[model samples]
Target: MDMVQSNQLEIRHISPEVRKLIKMYADVNNCTQSEMLERMILEWDSQQSQSERPPGDEDE
Candidate 1:
């Protein structure tokens, strides 16, 4: 399967500790910082979608 191309994302005002944690996580996971962030975003989106669904509507 072909991977989709990602556009650039620029964020500012993050604390140094958070930046260090992200870097550490990326290192442990063997992925770039951008990839780690993308994964985190996708997971967060999935969680949000699941929570937004009505109860007992799991089949949808």
Candidate 2:
């Protein structure tokens, strides 16, 4: 897990579509906006990590 200490997520830079999706998902999950975004970012990171691994190189 990452050790990010910052509490700021500048929403102004996010595309309108993504911003709306975030809001909708956050409301559905009953969590704070930042919390939802953090989960999303973490999920993306995990997916990327898995895809970037070389075949047959699953050592952790």
Q: All models: lDDT?
A: 0.69, 0.77
* Highest-TM-score candidate: 2
Error of 2 at 14 (Å): 0.6
Lowest summed lDDT across 10 adjacent residues in model 2 is found at 1-10
Candidate 1 C-alpha lDDT tens digits along 1-60: 212134124323456787678779989999877677667778889999989999989776
- C-alpha TM-score for every candidate: 0.74, 0.76
Q: Please, what are the lDDT tens digits per residue for candidate 2 over residues 1-60? A: 332324233665788998889889999999866778888889999999989989988665
Alpha-carbon deviation at 40 in model 1, angstroms: 0.4
Off by over 4 Å in 2: 1-7
Candidate 2 yields a Cα-based lDDT of 0.77
Candidate with the greatest lDDT versus the true structure: 2
